[model samples]
Target: MTSPLSGIRVLEIGDRIATAYCGKLLRDAGADVVMVEPPAGHRLRRYRPAGVPPSAGDSPFFSFLSGGKRSISSPTVPPELVDSADIVILGSTPAEAADLGLDVDEIACRTSVITVSNFGWSGPWIDVPATEFTLQAWCGSTGSRGEPERPPIAVGGDLGEFIAGSYAAFFALAAHRGGGPFDMSVLEAMTTSMQVFSWLRKELMLLEVLGRSTEVPSVERAKDGYVGISMATGQQWQDFCAMVECPDLADVPELRFQVGRWEQRDLIRARTADFFATHTVAEIVELAALFRIPMTAIGNGETLSSMDHFIERESFLSHPSGFRAPRAPWRMSATPPLPPALPPALGDTDSPWTPRESRAERTGLPLDGVRIVDLTAFWAGPTATHLLGMLGADVVKIESVQRPDGMRFAGGFREDVERWWEYSWVFHGVNSGKRSITLDLGSEEGRALFGRMVAEADVVVENFTPRVMENFGLSYDELRGFNEQIIEVRMPGFGLDGPWRDRVGFAMTMEQLAGLAWLTGYPDGLPTAPRGACDPLAGVHAAFLTLAALEHRRRTGQGQLVELPMIDVVLNASALQVIERDVAGVLLTRRGNRGHEFAVQNVYACAGDDQWIAVSVRDNDDWHALKAVLRQPVWAHDLIYAEDTADLIDGHLADWCKDQPRDETVSAFLAAGIPAAPVVQPPDVIDNAALQARGFFQTLDHPLCGPLPYPRPPVTGHFVNSAAPLLGQDNAQILGSSLGLTAQDLARLEDDKVIGSWPLGL
Candidate 1:
């Protein structure tokens, strides 16, 4: 199959991983991406990934990032390449861009320009340096990590930059039609995960906002290694209880819901641990499979490299020295992404640039005329469609009157409240900017009406387990009969045909399977499960592929089926760790609040309750600046650069911060241009001065929820400027006007329970 982006061209100018990863994504999608590296080499060449052996030369991390892209040895970008590019990715701050001899505004006039950086374009910290640890700390997710008495932990690897890079690709394609300059911030992309959900939940219900106290996703000691498990919904918990032979836990009234179960986590943890300890990993897997529990064995790098599922699916690819990586997170039927080639050597040559037909001048949004029929629920799929809606696609969400989105009743059913289905803040938060309409897909009349809508729809999206689509008789082939030009996006937990395709998997299960859980937490071998970032990662991956499919349709007048398995999303995010082990004999383990890239990164206790501040000394300059801030000079300046001195600096920062208040300590560090932030709580996120200054929040007025502010995802565009619709808010307009159904026809459908505004049997 031909690559979807076969004719598009991209010029990537930056040494940062965010830039390199952006180029890689475009290249993977089949764009001709030319990477500009300095004559000596990119800065990434100076270091190798952690745990990589000495024989792994020239940065295996860089090689994985620059895969499939031709590299030119140059101090400055070639003017011809920039002029002929459809997209130019500038992964630097304004000051650095000036040093690169690139004009952002001038180049944006001809092609789309996406600037990816750690901070914002016009901010006090714009030119300041940042690390993954510091960015995660500033985003507030790190604030809630680890023990309350000890320092918080950073999710290992350059995962933050990878996320920013992925967002950059989405921004690039999203702005293709609309020629413009766009800015993507690494911190902003992370905030859309733990931080946004943390604060948004507090704003809605004032519940347990962050994962500070309770741990729903906890790791237990299996006979061989460990297993990570979570019960996201009530049903999963019941099945888990039954499978473990603790049927008593299932019958407890308080344990019926996830929120309630969280209150008694210690008791539940003890019971599950006892069960897990008695069983081997294989035995636990058998039990989980028997009862369809959402759990998985916590695999390490070596285990991940040889998983039967991965081997069967051909999920991994490698270069020389056994340096490993996963394939692209998506697959298309007609125009599958080309398998990426190994990283190019410095000064490698490719064919001369030939620009394809330029897109028409976009009047407003890039996806102004596009229409999407959304059939997704829960976190990942809703995240994808919500982002698409923000890019100006007219997204019409479909839910059955009798069987609506499961998210509509997140806290479980309530007998007292009359309209319990409309009370989920999670549904409102994730599904914003789309019109909702109810229809019973179980009925024949409703299926026929859905077929008619498919005939006029540009794309159809869903996230059911594999059999649901086939059972509904609405697979891509079936939808093609309605409209041959329709693009269908499927987000299964696993791919369509894998042996594990039908396995009951959720966000946490995929995380365990990806082995990222093995690399998180403190220096201890036990896993500190992440806050289910995989789901949102899946969402971002899905949205990117949908646009690629749309571009394919624009080029070949062909619509294809695309798959974004959640497993692939997490694996791709955690790819570096797996590759590190592949290239080395040792496994990459966790170190709390510190990384191999930094000399000093720690969270110090402050004056208030649970108050703390994150500190990262990036390099020699930062180390000196930190010393100057503290008015403490080291007698041996020459020896200060050594790794042993990092321990001293960490101790010094802790002592200095322990006596002072968090605000004052953070202020001192920031004024000195050091990367430091207060470990902000969930409630404080709503009024964060930095996000407020960036205008990151938009107010959407809802009849029931009032005019509340919602954090916009990290992208520059005209998002849908409305709140989430009521269950079937647009039923009348869509059915009566668009479908040419008479008032009597609509009344009859509503009476027959085929269509309605609210739940049928509520």
Candidate 2:
């Protein structure tokens, strides 16, 4: 089957995770992408597991990123190839990119292009090094995450950068069809990624002014487990009290009122927790449905993976590489994309053209010439843009002098011991492909200049606090006045209107208010936050939304507001969990890494201290396997009908599992047709043989961060390909000539603080 984006060509250069993933999306849509890799490949190639066999001569990163596209050696690629490319992706400092003769202005004169960078080309820290963790910290994500006392933990799995890149891809495609070239900002991308937090912060500010509660009710602990109950309306509150069989409590004059309960929140929470402890997980979930309160169980990666919906929907696609990767969040019907066979080996194919499709014709390209202008920061917003970029949009990231996005200043402002891009690993992960150009949009002249750029852009994406845009007179109204056809995405913590419009927040805080954090810890312990759950969850939603909006624009000439509130998106994404609460009024509590609905389930210790096995039995058939593994019919019999089956099962299973070898148990379960998985470490995930068998990991001989490993595209469709991009490495060709900028003019822009060079220092 032909792909939706067939007949599109994308040229990706530089090191950015978002751009790379975005390129993969385009390839999936059947785009013919010429991924121009540096002499040593890219940084993503060096991301290896603890004990996996490293990439030999070729890059292992390809197993994840290079599935359907053609690979080309960057420094050695023929110049004609550059000129023939339809869209060029760049993500380097302005000066470094110009040195390589791939600047956006230069390429724009010859063909369409997109520029992506840490800050837009004009920012003060344009040349600073960066990583995803640093950016999360600087953007207030760390400050609000975890216990609020521990140092901020980076979100797991480089998700922040991935999100930024996803959004970049989304807009780039629209821009390509709309016009010529554009620029996207990484900072803006990150900010948009935190839509909910940004909105909440704004709301809190307004609340402070109004002299209302500045914070949501704080939850320190719960009896049954941590939980969050949101009864926004008076009737809902009344219903909730009744559902818990505590109607008497509601009759108390002070308790009867929502405002009053909030004032005495501590007492109410304690009372609520005590009530919840009496009920089981099932009972609470069912009862919440009866009362129509918004409630959900606290879950983790395991829960997300094991959801029946995801399994039935085939949200995860098995690869030749081993591990099953997730599918793209959004699915399209018209031009359904197919997943590729596997990631590419470094220079896996000898030529740019496969026998099936020649480079000269550029067949199989999904998005032929889409373009995007990215102005965002953090995770959510940038993630959406990156997805778009991956699908064959020319994504350009914009930046300014104010604080550069945090990712750009990672690694203590110094190069790593190896002098590689290690410190900037996070930056490279998110901002690949596209071009880089600096434009200080905060100044009057800069804003005017941006207005001109907007005239030529298809989509403008940002995640600034609502005030930032207004302060610079670059609000939606002002932007639309410049170009009504442009798609503008305004992502705040809360929506534009609300009582708490200016509250300060981040993913951690959002998780708490939205009830996620409250439900994640132990049943009797404080709430716990995941390493980086918010970024990926919010990013996936943003990506889904942006793509849907793009399709809407394609069908209609009108371009309207795309408002994604982080809190709202999270709430919606978690609707499955909350629906029961909203309908039944049963309060939810934390289960502490445990699952429900399975008579047999647990994470049991294995031969090693850290090694463990997660196994589950849904019916009698699996129970038989459990019996076989335990080799104890009497113990199994006791569990099946004992009055205290849970205790019996725990005791026997604990002893049995503690002495068993993890691999041996896993094998026995697989052999017996029981559902089991290892409680994997990062290294375990990175090195799983199953993943390798599925051709999941990609190998690349990166110039910096040497021989990195990257995971394959999570989703595979009917038509799919995966390709990553380089840094602002495509600037010269994109901005210098393609945008009609003269060499003299380009030189002047460089001197006038409009665009700076790459790798500025340390």
Candidate 3:
């Protein structure tokens, strides 16, 4: 079968999760992505899981991100090849770019480039060095993420940066259509994730106003195993009470639930804990399901593989190197990216093609002919389209002086700065092969131009609050009036028509309101949000909805609206929580890092502090492996043979894990045919040996970010190169040639500031 992104060629420069992930999406969709590796190779290549070998090919980071793309090694990139390539992605600091003699202006004038850097190329701290932890701390996510009073915790993985890259990919596609070498900020992309938190702060203001100050209980563990529960809606509360068999909760006057419940939640929680102890997990889950209360067992990425729903739905695939990942989140009827290749070795393929003339032709991107007009600024909306761009859509991003997405300044940078787009490590990941066009949508002229673009577009996506569209006179009805085939997707903090519809929110706020915050972190502690938790998951939902909308449009020839309230999406993810509350009257509290049931669950630290292991026991089949490594007969002899071993499992497992090296144990178990793997650290993920054998990470040389590692494309199939773009780099050629704009018109647009070559003062 023919691939979607056939005949598309992409050049990825700055090798980070964001750019790499974007390139991966494009490659999955069938684009030919050529990753340029710096002299030292991609940084992620050095990252290793505990006890795992540290080899370039073993980098899971590289394996997962670059599975489909080819790698090229070069420290200092020449301009000729970049100009000829369809996309160029670079991640760097201003100092780094300048030191490397990478002139953004020169590149923009020459070709389309997507520059990914620390604080954008023009910001006050544009040259500042940063890491995932620092960004998380700077953004207040680290401070706000875990228990309220404990030392702030960074979210697992370089999530903020990764989501930002996803957003960048969407913008790149948009620019690809509008034609540009455009600049985007990882910071702006990350800001989208903060919406919930921002809104929560506003809600806190109202609490102070109402003089409803009250002492709340910190989250506490119940007698049962650790479980994640939520109470987002009034219905959820009602369901929760019912699941725990507490019909009397309907009469509890002090609880004052809903959003207001947050301040007084501790008291209500203490009172509610007594009720949860009465039931088992089975009862809680069965009951929650009957009532539609949102809940779930808190789990890591690896644990998701064993879920019956996931297995039945076929959420994982085994690569050649023996690593399995969740299936690319979306299922498409046509041109799906599949059959991921293993991570490559440095200079793995020998081709004597000169950089300038040997552009890899990409005609096989999964969603090649699809068109998307992306209006998303931050994490969720941008992430959705980023995935779409990977699937081969022609995505054009709308930007303007009046309104720039917050990520432009929020990922991890000072407020007052120009060229803030470059410092965004996050932006580099989500966007790769899109196009860019600046328009003042709030102005009549801009709106008119947008309407014209919509008339020629297939999809319109935005993650702004619901009313923003109506205020701009750009609602679904308005857009459909212009183009009946358009699909409009709106992702608000909450649903468009609810009591809390106007309430502002970010990722934190959503977690709070969704009841997820109330259930995370250590017991008897302050509420906490997931680490960059909502963005990627929400992105998955958005991408799934877009594909569904596209399929619907295909059949009906009618435009449709796709709405994803961030809170609702969270509830969907936490469906298990809802089930327990509604049917079983179970009110779940928090449990820090502990797995539910504690039956064959753990991510233990190894002797080498940097290494770790993720283990699970579905049944009793893997007992021997655990027994062999732990040197305890209880696991195999006692637990397996005993009629009732449940009571002793947790204590025995804890004792066995205390002194063992997580990675070595995992390796021993895996060698013994057990289900085990070391917990992969963000930096170490790029060097996982199994991932290397599977051909995961692809290398790309960039002018700025040096030789970098990009995660391979998620889908496995007959796709090729997965490169990112240079900002507005394609502007002159596309406007002058494809858009039929005369040189005078291009000059006029530039003069009018309707569009500029780069947002940064290149």
Candidate 4:
């Protein structure tokens, strides 16, 4: 079968997860990707899971991300190859690229160039060093993770790099369509994961107004393991009560409302804990599903590997280790992704390729002429529109006075503040670069207005459940009547058609249900949700898929319904475990801070209060470097130490780290060529030298929130960086200009509450 990106040539020059995964995506899409590494092979090839030898070609980490691509041992790119490639992805710092004679501007002129770096190429701290641990901290994700009292803990796995690669692939594809050169910073992409905490911090203002604290727990221990539970809506609360056989608790005055339940969190936790103590994770999962409650067991690698759902879906690829690896995230009916193949040996150029001249340059942003009608609220849907807007699409965000986006009222600071809608950072963060208008779709006049706008829109995107558009007489079929060429992208939690289609889906619940919660957290601890990474993750997928659909439309002049299941997106992101279960019949479980790929890997406490550093020894080379850095400590000479005595190794390492300052220790290890980094917190991230140098954060002046620093899109391109529109801020402009409504008409509409600048009662 033909692939979507057939005939596309992608040249990848990098050695870590970010560039490797990006190349994998393009290769899966049928792009001819050639990965260039040194003669000794890339450092990433040495990364092997415990008991797996590098020579065995069974390093799950490498096999999973580096498959389906050819490799060369050239340290430098051939000018002829660079000129002929469709896209060139550079995974290097500006200095490194310069040293290799890879000129950013020169290569960009020849073909689409995506430069992925720790910070960025032209930033002040461009030379500063970074690692997954430091980047997560710098992105504000680390500070918001873990228990409140405990020191901040970075999320396991290379999440920062993973997110960066996703953005790189998306942007590279966009650039391939004449978007131009783009720079991607791993630190910036990781910040998207912290959007939830950014909102929660503002929500703390509301807690202060209510005379309550800002602490709340989202996870609880079950009889056998941990279960993630969320009672966000009244119905969910009732379902939870029913599932737990505590209908009386649901009726309690203090538990009747979300805020009340939160205020009495201690009591709620006590009661819930007592009830959960009697139920095993499996029992709770069954009950939760039966009652339609948003609950799921914290899954370990083992459980995820054995899931029947993944096996039935054929979500894994067989690896040589007698195991499986995850496949591509999305499925296309017409052009599916390529099957996984083993990575090529260094300098292996056996694959055939016909080099072609680069295409002519396009003058504007990739989506400059595209028009999108956005009806999304909260995180995931809005994220898609926001990204589209940055790509230069004319996005009209349709909201209503009576039912404004829940995000407008999310941050706590708005409760006692005037013009609270304008002051919501949560709303502003995702809604930036898009225009907002008010129209109550439930009303005939509002529906009529939307129909008129739909006729001129190229795409209509929404995240409401399946029936919402149908209820409003705005389903894809109905909208196609308004504009036959309009693309409708529907983002539902489970999917447009499924057993759980009608059920409400939230990031927390989706994470649990999709098996991310099961894969995260400590092995013996409760399954924990890492803020809301799934939301942004789903949003990124939604945006990438939308672009792909647009490309199809460009080819065939055809528009169709695009349904992106949030659960499916999350499942794809957590694809590693599916392999373990399907191929080896072993359920993957959590290993806490312990590393599965290396014998010596952990986070150790540092000299200062609540400070720590993450350390990982990839192989004997890293181990020897660490030993030298530690001045040949006695534990380093132990015979059993080389055989995966991780606990004993970590204990000794902790003792050494506790007496050393975080930065000095990390720097020393790094100098000794060891993989180590200081654990970063949010405050430090805001002022991080590397990020600051790269100008990763941009300041937007808002009417109410004043000037605030917002992380720029991880991708570099000719895109707009603007503040979010105020509630209904663009009603008059959009209605008057696009729909040809007169001033008097807009005035009357506002007077009738159909279009208003401010939210109701604000």
Evaluated with lDDT, which candidate comes out highest?
A: 1
| RMSD after Cα superposition, model 4 | 4.1
lDDT of 1: 0.77
Give lDDT tens digits, candidate 4, residues 1-762: 466677788989988788887888788777889887787787776664443333544345566677777887766766776777888999998878877678889888878998988777766646556666656655666555665455455565555666677778888888988985888777678866643535324332433221112223467877887777755455567778776666887787555444566667777677677778888877877777677666665555556545555566554557654556655766665566787777777778733356676587787788888999999987888988888888888999998998788776554333466675566556777887888899989889999999999999898989998888999888888998999878888888767664456666677776775566664566666566665777777777778777877777777777777777777666656665665455444555556666345567777888877777877765677777777888887767753446446677778888888999888987797687676666655445656666666665577776666666665577643344677888887887789987799999999988999888777775
Lowest lDDT sum, 10 consecutive residues, model 4, at 206-215
Off by over 4 Å in 2: 1-365, 410-422, 576-578, 641-644, 700-703, 716-731, 758-762
Tell me each candidate's TM-score: 0.94, 0.53, 0.53, 0.87
Between candidates 1 and 2, the TM-score winner: 1
Better by lDDT, candidate 4 or 2:
4
lDDT comparing candidate 3 with the true structure: 0.54
lDDT of 2: 0.52
Cα lDDT tens digits for candidate 2, 1-762:
335456667777776676777676667656677677777776656543211333443333344455666777656444566576656666666876776665567556665566676545553445544344334433334333332222222233344555556545654554445433556555445433422232222221222111112122233333454444443334556777787666876676655433466567666666666667766644664566556554444443234335443455554455455444444433333344557456555555444542223222233334546567778665556665665565566777776434344444431223224432223433444454445555667656557667877877777777776677788888877888988767777776645555334433345545654445544444555555442346545655555445544555576655556666665544432322332332233334555433323444555667875555666564677666778877766757645732236556766776887888887877677677666655442322334343344333455444444444443223211112222233333346666666666788767766765554443333
lDDT of each: 0.77, 0.52, 0.54, 0.71
- Highest TM-score: which candidate? 1
Error of 2 at 631 (Å): 1.8
TM-score: model 1 vs. ground truth? 0.94
